[model samples]
Target: MLVLMLSLVLSDSLVLADSLALADSLALADSLALADSLTLTDSLALVLCDSLMLWLVEELSLADVLSLSLALTLCDSLTLAELL
Candidate 1:
């Protein structure tokens, strides 16, 4: 009886994981559609990137001086490994 209950719970989790994947796919499609409608110029992109870089740089520790994005990634093991 316990085994039967465990199997049911496990199956439910598989269904949830599959659903999550489907949702992610839909989100990606929506994002692509939005990007397709936007017009970003090269100069504006560079300025935005510079501003973002400055923001990230400002978040670094005094001693280490790593970028803020890198610091945030270091806090999570999966992201750290993926970044490397």
Candidate 2:
């Protein structure tokens, strides 16, 4: 009877060890999935930032062109006034 009790205890400990290992594996998988998701999010953010910068550059270029044209018109008017 004592031997049977010892066997039962050993088997219970083994089962406990297996459950702990399974829990650790599940936790590690969850962490890996989170890391992958974060990486994807970062990539998308970078793309959005790049597109916004391009749009801003285009807007600035348009403003620059308008300013240049205005300056040229002022210069022409001044030249005509001096001639008159």
Candidate 3:
């Protein structure tokens, strides 16, 4: 009877050990997946920032050209008034 009790306890301990190992493996997998997702998110954010900078530069250049044209037009009108 004592032998049987000891065998039962040993078997239960083995099962518990197996379950703990499985839980650890699952936790590691979840951690790796989260790291990969964070990396992907960082890459996407960098791409969006680059696109925004390009658009801003284009808009600034366009505004500069329009202002230059307006200044030239004003100078021409002033010269015409002086001649008249």
* lDDT, candidate 3, at 54: 62
TM-score between model 3 and native: 0.44
Per-residue lDDT, model 2, residue 31, is 66
The residue pairs that clash in candidate 2, if any, are: none
Tens digits of per-residue lDDT for model 2, 10-66 = 999999999999999999998678558665645454454445446556666777656
| Residue-wise C-alpha lDDT for candidate 3, range 2-66, written one tens digit per residue | 99999999999999999999999999998677557655645454454445446556666877656
Q: Any idea what lDDT model 2 has?
A: 0.62
Clashes of each: 0, 0, 0
- Mind giving the per-residue lDDT tens digits that candidate 1 earns over 1-84? 999999999999999999999999999998678667655653344345446557656665655445544554343333323433
Q: What lDDT, from 0 to 1, does candidate 1 have?
A: 0.61
List per-prediction Cα lDDT, in the order shown.
Answer: 0.61, 0.62, 0.61
TM-score (C-alpha) between model 2 and the true structure:
0.45
